[model samples]
Target: MLFLTIYPKLHVVFALVSTHMADEDATTTKLRDRSHIDNTLRLTTAEPTPEFSAALKKLQNIYHSAIKPLETAYKYNELRTHEVTDGEITSKPMVLFLGPWSVGKSSMINYLLGIHDTPQQLYTGAEPTTSEYTVVMHGEKSRTVEGIVMAADNSRSFSPLEKFGQGFLERLVGIEMPHKLLERVTLVDTPGIIENRKQQERGYPYSEVCQWFIDRADLIFLMFDPTKLDVGGELATLFKQMKGRESQIRIILNKADNLATQDLMRVYGALFWSMAPLINATEPPRVYVSSFWPSEYAADTNRQLFIQEEVSLLEDLNQVIENQLENKIAFIRQHAIRVRIHALLVDRYLHTYHEKLGWFSDPHEVFEDIVSDPDKFYIFKSILAKTNVSKFDLPDKEAYQDFFGINPPSGFKQLSSHCSWTSGCLIDNIEKVISVELPALLSSLGKKETPPPAKATPAPPPPLPETKPKNRWRKD
Candidate 1:
């Protein structure tokens, strides 16, 4: 009985070990394929404004000459250089439209673009007809770009969307039109937020993808109909993500024309009560109460208010072009911070790994020697097995191996040396660009005069000599 029980347990243990090994192999293969994909699917850069172009080139030069080589040398896996640089340096001002079905999102977009007669515009309907994320951009003529082609175009922001998997890719569409408004703004229409649990059953990571767009958007328009002003489930979660971005968000109370003046007030008040907690704002966000011109079935009795709101919205949208440079600079600054943090973390790990490996008596000397003979860098494996890393912190073993593995020893050493030297330079350059150079440039562009230097106050004259003693004797 002892032998039988022990044998069964041993078999189970063997099976688990085999399964783990198989999983590891699969992960390794996947990582390798991903690297290959990245290498082959390099995107073309987008055409940005002159100022943005110059700044972008500076950043690109820094990465290519500094960060890239260092990351390669240290065998760091969380490379985001492409994410920082791939799209146009000067991205167009983006206005993202989000709401539930029948909130008049598509109708508003069409009205803004003045596409009354065109069937080529966004498909507007009463039901939840838009099931995809549609990107509307400026073009010479109206046309639709398939998701796959859009993914292949490195110049577009949608290039990154490819990684969300085929299910998401299948649900994406790009519309390019010859609209004067699009020349200054890109409008993004997202899928209507469904309240049901069935949305969760969708294979794609919906919230994650939406968050990506939210972070990049210059402004967000949250639409709500008076009839359906609910903010629950996925919508609630999305609003929570907009915590710090409250200033850039505008609440739109659509279909106000359908309600009587008193009822509209009631609905508006109710919306404020419901959204105040969700938005968590000290002051309620600006709400544009208007109906899209084409949707006149529920015409507003208060035509003046509707016209004023529409005009104000358009003016706000136009202001984005004027502030484009500021937005781009801000983006670059944020990207720099991310890169700096990544470099510091990788540097720490490399130092620890070298120390553990007993590569040299001094940790600094280890990198120096490694630079001379990169082939010996494969010795990293010995330390990797012993290293403890959190899953959330960095890429896993397979990803690391795919990026840093399979190189000839000499090539590895050379890359290591190159990266070390470049990373040092990169860190310094990035600091200068973000902290010192960019500020002065921006100040000059804004045409604000620098404050005159304050004059130094002269030191008080030396105390009069012997006056104190003379006064004491006289007073007595």
Candidate 2:
């Protein structure tokens, strides 16, 4: 038997014991049990400090007091922007996994979280196994919630997905597990991308749905199979849509064990060359080569490299947890800026319409014309130039077309005459949040919270004394 104890500044002792048996199986079981207990203790004992909790509360208050109202009054929700919800404010950091079929997206989730007592909540196979998007989160017990129910549930942040239509909602699901790591981060497993599949075949706007998740995800892993380095078809479209999100993306060349060390180098180079035209960044995104699932690569020469890369990736995930609060505030700040721009443009459109034609002119026709040829519209051009905002900063024209296309013309008429930006304090409040409130809150957080020190790569533990093998064991 072995006992380990750790003591902190107060001299309080936390002790754990592991019993060894002559049977190797029993010893392994004991080790696994000890690891599970250690993880639980760490999760339970490490409560957020009072200062951090208070900071979060203040962040929420800033959103409710300043940002949310601007969005509501300006009808930001009617625009391309996603409406922020309370569930998103309180949710954990989200990590999104994206790749083509059989690229091991689901397997990677299992590897990171299902190693302990949690059975694999996701299905994995050589073919397209995951047909729907699954959100793996923490809860008291294991259960599955259908997409319709999940989106309807006010406690979850999935309500925005409802806009994707009934076809998409039918394919979404939520899986809950009482796992230790999930308490720190949420994992989203997306349906694998298939080559030559048309958007019409999917019964929804696939690229648009992906863009929505991409905008909200804290980190995105673009997994690739070495055998399928060709980024043709939908994958190319997906990569192009990820423009300006280079910092959040990490490319993973999964299933590297299948190739020899030299082959891996050639495959990696090929992968980079293929991704160059699609990725809009000047520098290539970080690429990690490894097989995520538990498997033996004893004969492979890149085993050591795989171990190091895995550690680096795991560290990145830990960093996400540490910076969760900061990321949320930053997201809100950016959203506020976008809403401000949208409000200004809408106000400009309405004011121009009121000026050109007298009070009772058909505002709906004016709005339609503006949406159709925003670039040629003298008012839009003047507004962009005067405000020093780029044409790219404007909301998606297609999104506006679709929304107004389905709804009545009455909505556009209402929006045109209301002119929230000029009629109320919405613009002033949002500007204050973007300039003063958000910065002050972020500065206070920096003073209250100290970042954890960089973790050094741990030296490998000494190998167990040589003994005849009693049984073949797989790593958990």
Candidate 3:
């Protein structure tokens, strides 16, 4: 009897493991083949200003020809897997909405998309209704594209999101329509955060997916219903993850019509207090108090305030559209610097190992040596100092360790033979793109009368190009 019971349990476990492995294999096959039925070229349909388009195209050319090769050869792609595609740089500004269930995330999206009618574009309700990550974009006619098909397409920026696995892809969809606002900006609506759901319950990496969107988004709206002010579970985790990105976040006290003026004040105060620990910012994030749904304002006394707040929010969105090119350029410059640092650090790590163990030694031996010695960080510090790169620009320690821990460093070993800190021409090419090309691109984008307040500490403006510049970049 003991043998029989134990054998059955073992068989069940084996079956589950097999099913998981099979699921992974299927996901791998689907991605490798890129044979989704709707896998057609996804060209950008939204029309940006002609000048903006020309400048962005030029920057994209420079990036692919000059920066991408260095990033790929130095394994910077492995560190930050999201390759900057042309679509990503040229696409409309993305405004991402994230918040708890029944908080009006979808409703706000619909309101902005001008889909105010009986049948909403995205399902909305008091309970959890939106169960997918939806990207609403501009198109001639309204249509929905499946996530698997969208993810498989190289033209879209979402290919990087495929790493989240089939579970996330299935929950991702693109809703295209001929909306006026979408012509200027893209809106990403994420699934509502639930209070107590575990990662297994969700069946995907929720925070990681959110972080991916957060990192790329020009504006992030963290909407909240007046009824539920407590931030716990997934919502709290997200707030914590958004530490460095405080500038992008705009807190929305949605459905403010539900509260009277006195109650609204109390609720807003309470919400800020609850969030203070998580946000840890010097001041509370800008909270726009408004009810997004059409029906909410009809019966509410605070209709005027809501309208003013909504207008303010819309103006901010418009600013995002105006600043999109500059934002893209800013992001590209930051990414290039980070990639350069990543490449240089990887080169140094490998060179040190090559000197110690020579080419024949196991790569793991160097990784182990680094892991064993905490003092080895000083060596990296020295490299950063010499390069005038901040130590903070380095990749996350855990991620760096995991990469070197799992992957054989033979490729890096080969890279070290030719790509040392001082000798590599690729470094010079990348720097030229940074110091010369990008700033020139920025200048070509004629100065806006009053540019929006920068989302982060502004990158120091690149220095003027040298008179006798090295012809490091490709002529074309």
Q: What's the true lDDT of residue 401 in model 3? A: 72
Angstrom error of the Cα, residue 267, model 3: value is 0.8
The residue ranges of model 2 lying beyond 4 angstroms of the native Cα positions read 1-46, 115-120, 359-377, 385-388, 396-424, 451-476
- State the lDDT of candidate 2 residue by residue for 1-476, as single tens digits: 12322434223222111111211232133221122222322433445678778878888887887777667755678777467887888888899999998788987787677443246447766656777899998888888879998788777878788888899998888888787778878899999998887788888778888998898888899999896676887888888778878878888999886688888899999988877878888767878898776444446457666655665566566666767888899988888888777767666655655565547767677767766765666655665775436677666657656655664343333233433555346667777888889888888877764434325433332232344212111111
Q: Model 1 — which ten-residue stretch has the worst lDDT?
A: 32-41
C-alpha lDDT score of every prediction, in listed order: 0.62, 0.71, 0.71
Clashing pairs in 2: none
**Candidate 2 residue-wise lDDT at 309:** 65
- lDDT string for model 3 (73-182, tens) is 87676766556765687677899999988788987776565474535367766557788999998889888989988888778878778889999999999988876677
Error of 1 at 305 (Å): 1.0
Better of 1 and 3 by TM-score: 3
The per-residue C-alpha lDDT of model 1 at residue 345 equals: 45
Lowest summed lDDT window (length 10), candidate 3 = 34-43
- Worst lDDT run of 10 residues, candidate 2, spans 14-23
CA shift of 106, model 1, Å = 0.5
Residue 96 CA error for candidate 3 (Å)? Answer: 0.9
